[model samples]
Target: MSSISNRIEQISSSKPGAKDYINYLHSLSAAADLISYAKAIIQIPDGAIVARPVLAEFVSYTKGLADAREEVLIATLDVLKEKTIIFEEQEFLAREALAEVYEQKNEFTKAARVLQGMRLDSGQQHITDDQKVAVYVRIVRMLLEDEDDAGAETYLNKCALLIHKCNDPAQKVHFKLSQARIFDTRRKFLDATRKYYEMSLEEAVDADDRLQCLLAASKTAILSPAGPLRQRVLTALYKDERSVQLPTFKVLEQLYENRILDQEDVKQFAEMLEPHQLALMGDGVTVLHRAVLEHNLLAISRVFSCISFPRVAALLGMELTQAEDTIANMIIQGRLSGRIDQVSGFVYFDSEKSNLNVRQKALVRLDEVAERIAATSRDVRIY
Candidate 1:
């Protein structure tokens, strides 16, 4: 306690123009008591403005001494955080540098926790929106790396509120990538596929990075529930020339071509999937099971006009009751282009009707868009 008091008195009583106090800490560096001095200086009364230079000089002075660098930062932050009026700029710099140290050590949660403790998110904290988004993006990135989705999501939502206002295009890309990750983790494959594919097309992104995004799009498209919504993203990915480079390309190719997936094909694709992807769904079936069955059902309609329920069950490797129920559900959802015949033990295909239904849906969407535009125009005129 006396050493701390003497350190504060020295800084307070030193000549105003001379930064001898910084030199004083440097003198103690050889003695390895620099941190004790840094801690004491931060406690100076109304010394918020003086805090940044002391921390900055200490950071510079401790260069090459890795252990001392961390100690100096920790000492400065510990004392500064307790002060009612914090020195914001130095605090930001110290936390960021500390987070970098933890990140390099593969301590992702610690890195995120260090940044999450910053005051930048508060209304009173004076910082640009881009700056705020940058820190939030870093926090989200580390949280995701730690596989803490719930925590990542909490910070990601904060980023969303300010991301659009940000001028940094690079930050925007990072934000979008984080969003794709969150969506993928949550099993919202269709949305993830769209975001990934969209980012892959960006000219600003590096070629390797773009390809990685494209690969993610391909993988998620295969993982998505087979339906019109999934089909749209799949079609986009299949048409993208870069998707051919992905290991999942064969699966995407067969799925898009409506070719019946054989056991070998399914096995190859399953080998590439993550453990969560192979986990059982609520229906006592794996995600792969549902995707394969739904897709093969569509493929059957492409090959034969009609098929017996028993043969359908044999082709899909399912029982008669499950085959009937799956076909019925597909028909009800307007996914499969066929109707089931329980009495005749057959299913009938209607390719033309399915095309008509899709066209009708397109027109319905166009009508809704037009209505919204017209309503907007009316509101503008009233205003």
Candidate 2:
């Protein structure tokens, strides 16, 4: 310990050459003296020579030194692992430095793991709320970068618990953005759209960020199941004067107007959505395709009081059986106030009943369309 401790003092007081200090640390690392080296640094006094700043400088110096950079970081982390109870700042910085190495290498999940390795809830360290929030936010972002929403969510939950206590606007925005992203990835389009829309309205977030959030809002809104609840979010986005500038604005308008979305239109809008948003559902059709098909059926209901199954299938560009099934589902869910005349191969719509609360009254022959809309993925925007 005295060896490294005296060397740190020598370097700290004299500002020794980078080569000399780096070479010495490299030697210690090569000799497997990691524990001693780390302890020497942690053992430094806090009053005249604080552990926080000195540990930060030590970690900073090791970065980009090529051969021993990551090795030194890991060594420091190992030494401080169980001692975070006392050397919390040193351990945090050590882990952060190692995580940065992983980040630079594009190993996002590994970076997130290294960051979350800290025992934030152990209560042994005096880590402030802001510090904990910062760590949680970083872990969430890194996990998101890897497209691991479930993992990201675990950390975001920790942030949510303390977000109100956080004073930094940037961190708060990060927490909101991560939450919205998780909502989106999990196919909760309506909830995601609402969060993104809310973030867009925040002046605290810069214009580009706000614009991206608005675009995300519109995309999620378009992807949302065609329903009155989703329409509210779509309407709000379309009415946002600033939304007019977005390419997604037109799709949002179409969704708001309940107009049938064409294949070309869906294709264009699908271009902006994430792969998961376009992921195939159990029905062997993409989510966007499913949403568009249902939306078109809703449009059809508005125009025709009664439509033949063949005509509905032709209009929806799908098989007659699929059209019948889709319409039967809408009717049963009370999303469309209609009944299927299986014998006549036609669907009859009730304009008045369509306006009534779904649970207020069950339409005629509810069991005739016995197939219930599967609750396969409730994490989706619409329940």
Candidate 3:
């Protein structure tokens, strides 16, 4: 205990050329054992202020020298494993050093403790609110990426509290919007929608913030289940003074595609929309139709590939019977001219007209007509 206590005091005092001493210790065969000893200093009883400072000193010394990786690792382990009194002692700089080394080693829990230490030290003169917010957001995002939602949510709530302290109302709203978006990503759709709705209402009262809020609320509505909630959000969007430039078109087309609204509803929505909105709808429809054609064409094309027909159809979520019928119909229409391989049951598209019989030729002609219709529909911008 005396030797360990002396080493801790030497670390705390950081004598001249102290880095050399740490290197010398690292070179010792007993360096790992010394690290364990430093860890025990941190674990010493609560009223042991002298011991805590010594442990902190040792940590500081190790932090200043890269050769102290073993010591730093052991200190970090004490925080997680030994329930050492890091939080109460204000040994943040020591914890920060430990976190840096652990983070370099891809040890997230130790890195997270750096944030916790900062949180404990947050009211100190040096740690500003902005710095605290930055740390909270970083740690929360890391936890989120690791799928530790509970931990992330705790930090996010802390971030939200700090954001609420911002003097600018707009900045506060921005933070709230960000909070809502994070919740949305976690599939807490109702919470997201509620926050978005409140923001939209509040911002709509201010003409300058209205458009920004409309865009946010529109996105929230799109994610929500089709019901009064979505309708309410849409209604709020439409009521905004800048609603003319808002995203009504894409939302309507998306709703139509999802079968949440019918053709008559689409027509009504188009009529209610501005010219730019109508143009946007036309663009969405064109893209949708092209996607559908590509999906079908790609499915048919794959039948000629080495892949099994049923396997391709199953992947496309089409019934094997429907796939067969569709292929046969395409052959008859002359859009596709191919004989089904007897062994593989795969259709091979033929380029030569002479290769097609009378029924096949007629079918190919019909397919040409259908392709023309599809192309015309895709090219026309009715909006």
Q: Write the per-residue lDDT of candidate 1 for residues 111-182, one digit (tens) a residue.
A: 999998888755545799999999999999999887788899999999999998999999999999999998
Which residue runs of candidate 3 sit more than 4 Å off their true CA positions? 1-90, 96-110, 113-139, 154-178, 193-220, 234-383
Better of 1 and 3 by TM-score: 1
- Candidate 2's TM-score: 0.81
Candidate 2 structure quality by residue, lDDT tens digits, 209-257 = 9999999988888888776677678778888899899987766777778
In angstroms, how far off is 137's CA in candidate 1?
Answer: 1.2
lDDT, residue 335, candidate 2: 64
Q: Write the per-residue lDDT of candidate 3 for residues 170-242, one digit (tens) a residue.
A: 5455556556656655555546766766776674247556555555555445444433234455565555566
Output the better candidate (2/3) by TM-score: 2
* Per-candidate clashes, comma-separated: 0, 3, 5
RMSD of each: 5.5, 10.0, 19.2
Runs in model 2 lying further than 4 Å from the true structure: 1-53, 64-68, 82-84, 352-354, 359-383
Candidates 1 and 2, the one with greater lDDT: 1
